[model samples]
Target: MISVLNLNVQHRGAMSGVLTLGSLDPAFEGAPAVDGPVQLDLRAVDFVEPAGLCGLAALLELLTQRTEHVSLALSGRNVAAYLERMDFFRLFGGRVEVHPDVSSLEERERHNPGTLQELINFHTEEEIPRIINRISEILKGKEYLLRERVAICSTLSEICANAAEHGTSSFGAFAAVQAYNHIVSGSRRAGEEVIISIADGGPGIRETLARNPQYKDHTETDNEAIRHALEMGVSSTGELGRGGGLTLVAQISARSGGSLSIRSGAGRVTVYRDRKNSRNVPPFPGTFVRVSLPRHAAEDRP
Candidate 1:
């Protein structure tokens, strides 16, 4: 039996929300049939509740391994208006549609070259969605397909996110996007050639590994450090599932015919879309990677 679960909950600081999950049969009615394959509707909601979001995430988790469509539609005045709204999506990695009555924002974004909104000087955990949305707008200006937008956004996100996670991000890392925008907009003053550059004054990757016998044999050179980090099985971070983060970026660049350039330990390596030149040159102490996608190619079917 197909059913709908409607919930209303009040949070401590945020507004109350009306949340709904469809095909949530009390009997687990469809049992294994409730994958994201299930349809969800929140278009009728006024505001969202975190518990409700949790309930939805729980449902998605159960349906994760199943091959089905658990689709949901949400219409809200603000995409992230509800507290814990982002937490829900992060839980299941499930894609939820946040539709506002955007018959016009879509149209403007479709034709307008782009819009840059300067967020906080330093970003906080609370600021990620805004950045993502900004990049989404830029990609839209570039007229990219959905997958391409996702890829480019993810690449940009990884850089920003890693900076926050490992660097000086009490509120969140700030310099990178600031720098990127300054470069992209040609607004930088004199001799400041950069889109964004995030620097972490922490111990370098080489220094970190020197303390560990496992990777003690590894050299601290920029190319070697990056190559090692991007190859899987090695990470300056002791955290599990991390040795491959940079590797994923490399794969994305290779697959999409984009470019991946990184400046770390002592230099930089730029992997061009043409797969022609991947240079390794000595530079500074911080790690920075930049990727540029052609305007027309931002939407090349994945």
Candidate 2:
């Protein structure tokens, strides 16, 4: 018998739905071995941003590992088309199955102005610089100010470097970036924002930091470990002048009046310019980072 997982897409407007990392919470609970084949039903999903895209990719990777066959059931043409533009099929087409075959969708142009970077997979630190360079080039062509571009690129490079160094899962890491013309979530729905999401399957922050005896107190909980990891010069390696990348990324987001969120194990923490918030959630197999950089109208180049 095939196990079916119904995705819980959040309602954003009257008729549109958004798939977010929190939307996939149900699938992570009561983790069970996938027997036989599996199906991910995304018929309710109307749109997927960078965070959701990366989350979905990570979920698929997890499922495929337990089952030889996994299929996706997509509903509307728009959702399929959006995924196609994001290069979702190109990365997972060979391994995973798709319903309502997207062959026709694939024939369409593969360009989305809002997309700064498409779904990308990387395994080692050696690939971080190239990925950063490509996105930097993309941003250069847009109307983004030099400072905006620097913040975006720095956030990506730092998180990606960390992913490559620590995300040891066989599937490695996945990242995606999207620039929304209008704020998609949160209190405001009118400002432009860029979202970057990266997920990796690894031992997670708590376990990783536990490797260092000096971080024993900080590693007591996933939230503690993540919070401590955000401090400048703190790292599992405990090497001087190391582990500042994430701190820098957090600072960049804060300066932009955006936010940085980290999730691992059973903890989720979000850092803002004024304060930090933490919560306990379903265990994530590895570490996930989502950064939001909002573009103020006054600051954007005309």
Candidate 3:
């Protein structure tokens, strides 16, 4: 649990315990107090999103609470972005220290996307297959097994296609396609992370899924609709879903050690946290399902 590390805090091997990246220097107190600055190697780190940033801010406050003087260093592209956000900056109050840039956070964010993100306002039902195929192809050439690759591809296709078919049908196909295409064009905006939010003007998932005769109007059960969808032979698509798709998706996720999230009506949101995030997830009103899994690791697990 105790060892010297660079600024970035790479484990250099498999880790056991949870590593807390508090805003303050975790080791400033116990160290011998070296004269020269400690070069924290943060190159291995990616960005922490708004949610994750909240956790980091909480840790910083905890440090302030527990200790007297904890030196603060803002390095890495991601750490800087969190600091830049108005919402995140509120964690440290109005007067936040604008430190010198250790790495070009802006430049790095330009090319590499972090694990979990939302691609709001870009994708449509008609083009769903194309994106799923593209991601599958990316996974195909990787070091993962062929079966795992196929599983990820299929699960993504089902979740997204269902989201589009059911969620966007009310908006007319052409308009939906145009709206989604716009999202693809502008993947990067100054203050926005690309996220896809698909909302349907039709009946919500609760109203729709419970209509299935097999469900027997059991709306009160915990995660009933979602669980039924994950059951072996439940299909909301009627003829389109010959048997079970979401079940397959859930099984694949469970086998791969990934996560799946579902939000129905207005009061329900279920998030299945995989180790990381993937390119697919249903986000918005109606029935929204988002699957955030790594392209390869999902297959590498079990």
Candidate 4:
């Protein structure tokens, strides 16, 4: 019989999902010796954000690299459909079987193969424009000024490129975008918001930055690492004008009334307008960056 492992529902997204993955090491302590399929029980998981979905994909990809067989047992029809929409099944490449056969599996065939919702490997330069164009399309009717859109796209490119260059993971990096309405005090706002998250299953920010000789004397916890990483000139490369990406991103976020949050190692940092906060949490593998942009109101409506 195959051993069944239950995926934690509480830690289903963002940094929590990464932690949940880290907690599964014991389940696969001797995975290569197992001859039968390893069942991943996903019945308890009802919701997952795009970042969380990517994290799970990265985890499964790692497991498959170590073992021969892995299967997914979805808990319910809704969860199955959710996974389908997120294209989670594609990661296994026909290796894993679903408990209940998904009916709309063929619908994926109709989707454009170039769609940006598809996971992007950090190695490709061509994928960056597709991602930026997709985000541009999402904001087309939202009346963002051209300069604002440029800033957002540039920030995205820089962040994703950084992931590709510094992540140092065999699994690479993944990014996804989602747009939704923002509600406050039981009321919906006039503007919509887009959330874009990028993640990589590599060493966390603190570990990566510690390689720089200049930072050797600087003692940094996870939270401090995140903060320092965003400063204008701080970078592991230790070169002049090398570390302005996150700083520029932070400036754009503040100017546009958007928000940015980053989680790496055991710390999480959030910046909203003029305010910034950091906290300690369960340590997560690698780094995750989430950027949220609100619709611009100052632009002329077309």
Candidate 5:
């Protein structure tokens, strides 16, 4: 029998959720590699951001490859409904089994085409704008300022482009966006916040960076690698006029009072409100990036 893996709900809302998912790698690694089913318990999970779902999908993808079967036990009615609305079952389909077996995957897919579009995998460069345009529409619906939308889209475009060019994954890269109502702490006003997550199962940042002769001497730990990658003008390709994607994302996060978190290999970095923190955590197989952008008025643009 496989031990049940419990996911934390408090961390299931944004960048924190991606880290929470990364922390599970060790547990899964320690679990016995039996042919029987492994259970993922999501009973305590109350909130799940798009980043969380993408992380979960990546974890499930890894688990499905290693184990013979995998099952999910959802906590409550609300969580079940949330999963249904997100079309989680349809995405995984036969790869993951839901306990108590609610709706057929085919039925869910047929009814929830719109939600499925929010979580997508892209392989070509042309598909990047389609994802960006969809996210722009969602942000526009929330009344975010045009400048803010442009900044967010620019950051997203860079990150997605990086994934396509460097991720080197046969399965391609995954991008997901989730918008939800959140309270702005000091203002005490409810506003819409959107989280954008892009992940790929490929050689992580450290391995990629080591390819450059200049960076070869850096002796980067995973955290250090992520930090270096975010530095302006740093590129694994050793090319000039190229390599500011992550730096732009960081600037957007700092200026807008948002947050950016990236996990590659065993290192994790979070930048929020102009402060940056880095640490070594459980190793994630590939690269996972989540950017949280809160609603900002037109005048708030920097």
Candidate 6:
């Protein structure tokens, strides 16, 4: 019998029917020994964010390793079209069988100005500079202030660099960035926002930090490791001036009145300007980062 794994899109909540990084089920993360066909059912999904898109890509990479026949069941025209715009099918379309044909959506895909950077897969640190230069050029054509552009690009490069350095995997890494006209998923407030996300299939934060004996206490739990990672000068390598990239990225987001969230293993943490919140979540096989940067409207800006 074919095994069916539901994407578990939330039914009711602030993120109802929306797939985010945390929406992924832990079952798939643990049961990678499958020898039979597997179907990822996402028909109930209505929307997806940058985090969700990258997470989904990472999950598919993991599933493809265990089984030959992988089917993706998707519903909703809007969601399908959005995925097409983000080049999801271009990356994985040929890899999986789609229940309902989405070829039409792919054909109709048009340039989305809000898509600062569509989902991209990179294998090494060398690939990141090109990605950064491309996104920087895109930002230049937009109305973003110089500082705003720097913050977004810096946040992206820092996380992408971290993923390339510590989270290297056979599948490499995935990154995406999008600007929304209004606050859609994370918060209830009204304002324009930019969401940047990156995910890599490397060893999780806990295992990476555990590599260094000094982090034994901090690596006791996934949450502890993630929280410890946010601190300046914390990394698997005990070298000076290293491991401060993520710290600087967090500062950039906080200064913009935005937040940065990181997830790996079973821990997820979100950091804001004034405080930080940490929680235990479903196990994510890789390190995932999401940054939210709010864009104040011209009328509201001083």
Q: Compare the candidates by lDDT and give the number of the best one.
A: 2
Give the top-scoring candidate (TM-score).
2
Question: Residue 208 CA error for candidate 3 (Å)?
Answer: 1.5
Per-residue lDDT of candidate 2, residues 1-302 (tens digit): 87888766766663258888887877766335577788888888888888889988888888888888889898868888888888899999988999988888877755447447889899998878877876676656546678867877876776787788888999899988877777554335456777878999889989988999988888888999999999988888888877887788788878867888999999999998889999998888899999877756655424
Scored by lDDT, model 3 comes in at: 0.40
- Flag clash pairs in model 6: none
- Candidate 3 colliding pairs, count: 21
Worst 10 residues of 2 by lDDT: 183-192
Worst 10 contiguous positions by lDDT, candidate 5: 108-117
Error of 5 at 183 (Å): 3.6
Taking all chains together, each candidate's TM-score versus the true structure is: 0.46, 0.91, 0.45, 0.76, 0.84, 0.90
Backbone clash pairs in model 2 (N, Cα, C under 3 Å; residues 3+ apart or in different chains), count: 0
Between prediction 1 and prediction 2, which has the larger lDDT? 2
Where does model 6 exceed 4 Å of error? 12-14, 26-33, 112-114, 137-142, 185-189
Clashing pairs in 4: 43-75
Error of 1 at 122 (Å): 3.0
Q: Comparing 4 and 6 by TM-score, which wins?
A: 6
Tens digit of lDDT per residue, candidate 6, span 1-74?
A: 77888766779866798888777765455446667898888888898988999998988888888888988888
As for candidate 2, its clashing pairs are: none
Query: How does candidate 1 score on lDDT?
Result: 0.44
Clashes of each: 13, 0, 21, 1, 1, 0
Task: Give the clash total for candidate 6.
Answer: 0
Considering lDDT, where higher is better, how would the candidates rank from best to worst?
A: 2, 6, 5, 4, 1, 3
Cα misplacement distance, residue 185 of candidate 5 (Å): 7.6
